[model samples]
Target: MTNLTIIQQSPDPEQVAERSRTRRSIADKIRGMGQNRIGALLLLLATVVAILWANFATASYEAFWETHLTIGVGDLQLDFTLHAIVNDALMAIFFFTVGLEVRREFAIGELTSWSRALVPVIAAVAGLALPALLFVLVAMGSGYKNAWGIVISTDTAFLVGALALIGPRVPGRLRVFLLALAVVDDIGALSIIAIVYTANFTPLPLAVAAVGLVGVYFTRYLPSGRGPVYATLSIIVWLAFLASGVHPTLAGVAIALLVPVYRPDRRDVEHALELARTFRQSPNSEYARAAANSLRESISINERLQSAYAPYVAYVILPLFALANAGVVLSPEVLQGAVVSSLTWGIVAGLVAGKLIGVFGSAALMKITGMGEFGPGLTLDRIAGGAALCGIGFTISLFIVDLAIDDPLAQNEARVGVLAASVIAFILATIIFRISDAMHTDVDPGQTLLRPVDPKRDHIFGSPDAPFTIVEYGDFQCGFCLKASGSIHEVYEELGDRLRYVWRHAPLTQYHPNALAGAEASEAASLQGRFFEFERGLFTDQEHQRPSDIVRLARDLGLDVDRFERDLTAPEVTGRVQDDMLDAEAMGITSVPTLFVNGRRHTGPYDAQSLIRALSEGPPEATPEPQHPGG
Candidate 1:
């Protein structure tokens, strides 16, 4: 206390500013872990812990996960073992994330069109059918015939984790193919659960679930506080599904599909930003809370909830699930029986050999029939490697074991088979990927332009006098570009007036139909000094970008609607759009979200740290001349 009494703090504002900057830098790094690699590592760790605990402390492992728990009001109490709770309740959240990912892919990702989705859809169907056929053939007269669904579904988490372990040598497009295939596989798994695994169907609870979903649909339009409403409706749907005899987790998917993917109106967005700016300019507790609420209301509920639940589902729910379900007590007798069990052989053959054949064969058939062609970097060997990785179906396989097979012996045998097959798949995929990596030579297409900022023509933000300028050539309809917006905002926040951002259009018109219209809308808004506002609106609502919608957004943003409409159709505005496109073509910038920091092309990920590093290092020694004037 005596020593503390003499303590003093530095009055230098630079030191205080330096400390704040350091804290923000740390925060940026932490927030940049959205790639889910850490989640995969955590899942792997949980699985290892489960196996060690099952063998070393058998009684404790069983007793902990097997403990019964009950919750409800009055006589409406529901009871379940800890294991059941993890599977039936917590896993619903995980499944909800999967459903969101699926919806997002279908909405704006590579699967947005039939041309892109066709091969994956066919492959997934074949992937499911072949495994089931193989399982039935292996277990035909052996009584475990109905457990075919156990091997049909691929475990997204485990497969992704194994791929992540293979490092950056893997092609990006191949990863997209596997992820899309897994999503389609999940759809098939849900169909199987609904049709094949249900013991009985009840009309009352099924109807109640439908009503609960309707409530969720209406809640999307709520002016404020939709979270509690969604949570309540989700619970009702889950309970009804549980009583209806359909697997309860399917409710999560249904609810996720119902979440609104559209952005709020421009009035709401402007008001929300005003509130936020007011709070920042003059801090007060009331203003702070109001700004927070307003900002939350501005974002779509789907995005808000996804960001909120992603970490919890990834780290806590999945790790706990792995710990509870991955344990297989391998006694001498159990091991001997598992080695010879028809169920074990059926699962092993179905997952490993069956997945490889089903995935690769179906893809070949697609190419051979001229129904679909391979994506970029997806050669025969890479596809085969990805197909092998698809066999690592640990999580979902165990889930189906609990559903399709009632016999404990069969369950244990199936678990053992799943564990062994996953290891085999990982090893096989790694070797194949390594070989493919060595066989292929990495080629750089020499894209990404190093161009100076043209303040007069560009849609600009931040101080005009800033030393560093960040240029982003991006499309409104591209999902990755939309994701990059967050990273860009973070960098803007950290650098403040030290940095400026100039946005240029580089829409992939072949992929995004509304991209041209969106770009014109942004240009029109810029004539009224609302370019950033309109651009943000377009990015937030990729699905709702008709001409009428764009005009309505401008009108709501306090612009003169007639003037906006005139500017939207003006030849000069159209010329501006084409000018950016011409620049993109000249620079060989084929992809959206290409960036330049301080006149040097930034090739790294558009995350905060990477951008900051590029900025700190400054531009290259010689500045390349701008390809086009006023660009």
Candidate 2:
């Protein structure tokens, strides 16, 4: 007998099932953490601990946060208490992350176009203005009318966390809208901090800060050492702002706004790929260094800095800020005083009532006047619930209290109101979402296509008037989507002209980094009348859809490579992909390779035989009533 015997054993089905279950569990946990639910819980725990410490061990709580620290080089030194360090220094990083997000949205995200941004921008303005107005109305005679700035901002971290805890049935569109609104709210709050609260008017230091900001802006053109340059300039700006007696945290925002943000350039991506190939073939230190640097340089500095700093800001900085700032003594005297304090009632009414009415009313008015439109499935009811959640203002509200009110007793009263309002907002939002979900219980959003297939806009692979239709919401980088592509090909072959197959971009960006790039590249290719061909190329090499790889595919298919590169970032191309994604979201299609036959969603295995059977069955019978409960 030969020593080498060919033998293969099939894997156990139970083991496979176990692995799948394990993967799903891990994914769910990761998703929860990414949504900042864990961070929010940590913040809440910190606030509770601070409150308990302040009540039971008031002297120790005060002593601990009051401990002073100093840092310096040579003759220059800076001294601050632990609480000031948390509020002034670490919080700058938090605000820097906020500025990065704002710049990104303006450059490439939801606010890239006026049409898309109108509703959120108007709503955010109203959300800010109305809260301040309400606060002033109630607190005008309380000797703290100037503290109206305290309620104009929403705490984004808590807002997102509250939504996660509430667990709305379909919160995708609503969450996006609220996040957009929060970004604007942050701008308003930062403006108030800079314009309304600054006490000193030192022109020399302000001029120095402006120079540092200009230096930071020019660092993007540097061929190397931009990171160190940015770091040096940012420090200078922070120190200048601190010396000027303007809020030092605003310097963080200034530096962050100056950081360049853009889509990845084709040339830069190709250069990186070339370096990567060299490193792979040579396996040398020099090539490795070059390849790493190239890859890092391909992504915009704004995005890179945001990724580097977001985790620290969310998990460490914000939690530490809460611990330092939320230590209000809730004694019987304070509670009784707060009950009669107009300042307390003003904060509650501003955040709770003003945020709800302002945000929801503006969005509703925009819709009614046809000034702007909401994303699919972002119903007025969901917007109302989201607006209620926006009332949970904690971080900035407390920070503003410290700045806007000097009296310890008044600060304590304001803290109580912020905490109480947050709790009330969470409860109110939960109730509203529950009611909305219950009212729409008869509608199953995931079972039907929200948008009809349009030949002029969609990527179609067969005759437009085909008797049978198959539409797929797919991600280019998904392994399952690649498999589904093969099955779709088989179906096309079997049905010939009878089948009209459509591909809609539903990139699961959380899992697939290159999926959105591939989607945009395909849309770009579609402009040259070769969408299906480029799509087939993407599926053929699903593992390598990098920017470089996409451009190479375009060249291989004899496309106008230059125009293709330009079109890859064209607003129309990006919008086309976004439209498909929004439609998929409206239908609650969270995963890839979701199929629809005729107009009804097809659920189950999407093999060629199964899909063909689905296509043969045709569209399901329509109910007499309309499907959209919100409509």
**Model 2 over residues 316-389: C-alpha lDDT tens digits?**
89989999999999999999999999999999999999999999999999988888856567888899899999
The 0-to-1 C-alpha lDDT of every candidate, in the order given, reads: 0.75, 0.83
Judged by lDDT, which candidate is best?
2
C-alpha-based local distance difference test score of model 1 = 0.75
User: Which residue segments of model 1 deviate by more than 4 Å?
Assistant: 1-35, 167-170, 263-268, 280-282, 285-287, 368-370, 442-631
Each model's Cα RMSD: 13.8, 8.3
Give residue 557's error in model 1 in angstroms.
19
Candidate 2: regions farther than 4 A off: 1-35, 73-76, 454-457, 460-468, 477-500, 508-514, 536-549, 552-559, 585-592, 604-631
What's the true lDDT of residue 562 in model 2?
93
Which is the leading candidate under TM-score?
A: 2
The lDDT, on a scale of 0 to 1, for candidate 2 is 0.83
